[model samples]
Target: MNGGDPPFAQRIAQVSESHTTRIFTRAQQMRARGRDIISLAVGEPDFDTPAPILHATARALADGRTRYGPVAGEPGLRERLAAGFEGFSADRILVTNGAKQALFSLFQVLCDSGDEVILPRPCWVSFTEQIQLAGARPVLVDTDAGFQLDPDRIAKAVTPRTRAILINSPNNPTGAVYGADALAAVAAIAAEQRVWLIADEAYHVFTYGDRPHVPVLGLSPAPDGVITVRSFSKQFNMTGFRIGYVAAAPSVIQALTRLQSHTTGNVCTFAQYGALAALEMDPALIDRRRVALRRRRDLALGLARALFTCAGAQGAFYIFADVSAHLRAGQSSADLALRLLDAAGVAVVPGEAFHGPGHIRISYGCDSATLGRAFARIKEGIKEGL
Candidate 1:
């Protein structure tokens, strides 16, 4: 153990540090230093967890429900969650630590060394790392200029080693919602190629205008080999609860449950009850959140368009703006994001991490007033960059 201890494994050292995390960490540091930093870097709702859910968790703990529960999740919560989709049952749902864990474990089960997962960029930051961790290759294919999925591009990226195709609607970072036609094309491609199709619909409840989040599982005939991953984080402000579930064939659930039995097992026992309470929440409350997010989206988009070229933000509470026009002298998106943090006290995620350089992802989950001020600072910051 000499020489500063043995070197860590190559796998651990070779992984890319998440750029979003870098920005988030820096913002936290600035905040600790008493800086008035406005962080739009983290993908979390600013809203409070609904009161009913909090009370439910409290009640569960009081009832001696703190002990470890089923690895496949509490049957009550699973049954409730499954009720939304026809044919889904508690036996077919395996709740995990988070949608993140569900995704990670799914990849581990689905891919092996050199197996390829077709990913459309700019994607969520974790997809590549998760695929890599599973000993698989993340074959990234860039989206169209408007950030929409081009099925032809996906078709071209597929190969014999392809294990799955991962898609996110109301996607993280870019906030682009893939259209039904495009998803259907992908569904056909997955079935024809005999590969898995994973749909991360974590932001399904936040779609705007005519752009609705379509689950691949709900597609007509619902192509085989499809796995749908969802989380309570965004919709219910349950990020801290860490409850997310996956819906697939019963066989997939069995496999995940087996893996879960060895891994973290069930999510917090009481947290599952909180999630059940969340399901019982009035839909009106959700509508209000969506309304608020839609307004914030507009405010952020208006400010972004004034400074840089950006596509229509259809879903998710983010604006993926192209900052290349304002970038000067070899400044990558990360550099510009850093400059925004330092110069304007505003924090945003660099699009480079999402495989879309010269762009930035601005989360509008902040309050409207905060968003207004942040956007003002962003305008000034971009001006300074020019």
Candidate 2:
């Protein structure tokens, strides 16, 4: 075995690099080299972890609560999670390292070689990759102008091999929050087609409209094959803590728990306590953050529309603007992103990585001043063709 040789699994070799992560890495590298970069690339909150949660974590650390726990999660945390979902119980929950890991484990357990999972385009970058990593095919369905999942498109994409339909509400990249009617249509399709409906509700707590965030599980005559994945990372500003969970049928939860036991046994003990604390703490703090994010969303959308001719944001902390209006002949989103970084010191993820070319995702999770500066640079960069 030569050191320079690629020793390996063919499956691993076939995997492609994650576009968002690559862009984020490049931005970090440029910043390290002393570039004055204002990054709107990553989909994370720019706020500090809420004070109560921080204090709770500190207390847990001082209480000598650090030890290996259940593979599913700390028993009490799992109970709390189950209770959080209105009609679910502990049997329906399986907590894992992060929502990412929990989702990976779910895909591993549910999908097999040649299985098909229907994905909505302009999706989170990881969805397709995760399906491929599970030896499954991702069947992408394109959304409308607002990026809402079209039931007709999803229905057309279904086939014998189609085992599941994965949806992200308050979606990443595009902030289209699926409404009740659209969700009902999807649930109907999944039920009729006998496919799993996996809803990623990581942004569940961050809705800015008249309609509340509706989970698939909450639908009446609930699709028997629905699974809801939730994360504390975004809601509680606990991304570093790496704690998330899934709620589904008892059998599905059991399978995921078994898979977790053989793989990463459990999330960090203290993190579980921290998450529990988040659930028990003042719900008002989360509401406050929601309002703040809504304000950011509105500001970013206004700036995005002023700069580009395409769609503006509706929900989530991101505004996915079509940069095609500004594209030069043969220029890719990568080129535009690099030019923006070099000329205006602002960083954003190109849409090609999200399977939609000629666009970019701008995160508005930072403070108002930082967001103002970032958008001003973006405006200048676009006008100057940088």
Best by TM-score: 1
Candidate 1, position 207, lDDT: 89
Against the hidden true structure, what lDDT does model 1 obtain? Answer: 0.89
- List lDDT for all candidates, in order: 0.89, 0.85
Model 2 worst lDDT window (10 residues): 308-317
Worst 10 residues of 1 by lDDT: 215-224
Give the runs in model 1 whose Cα sits over 4 Å from its true position: 220-222
Candidate 2 residue lDDT tens string, 1-386: 67787678877887778877887888889889988889898889888888878888889899988988888888899898888777778888898888899788888999999999999888888888889899999998999887877999999999999999998987888877888888888888888888899999998888788456788777735544899898999989998999888989999988998888888887899878888889998888888988999888877777778987555365678888888878889998878987887789888888988888888888888988899999898887777778
Candidate 1 local Cα displacement, residue 84, angstroms: 1.2
On a 0 to 1 TM-score scale, where does candidate 2 land against the true structure? 0.97
Please give, for residues 1-386, the per-residue lDDT of candidate 1 as tens digits.
56788778877775899998889999999999999999988898699999999999999999999898989999999999889878777887889888999999999888889999999999999999989888889999988988888889999999999999999998888889889989889988888888999999999999888588888776735444889899999999999999999988888898888998999977899999999999998999999999988888888888778888998489988788998877878779888898899989999998889998999999889888998899899887766652
Per-residue error for 223 in candidate 2, Å, reads 3.8
Residue clash pairs of candidate 1:
none
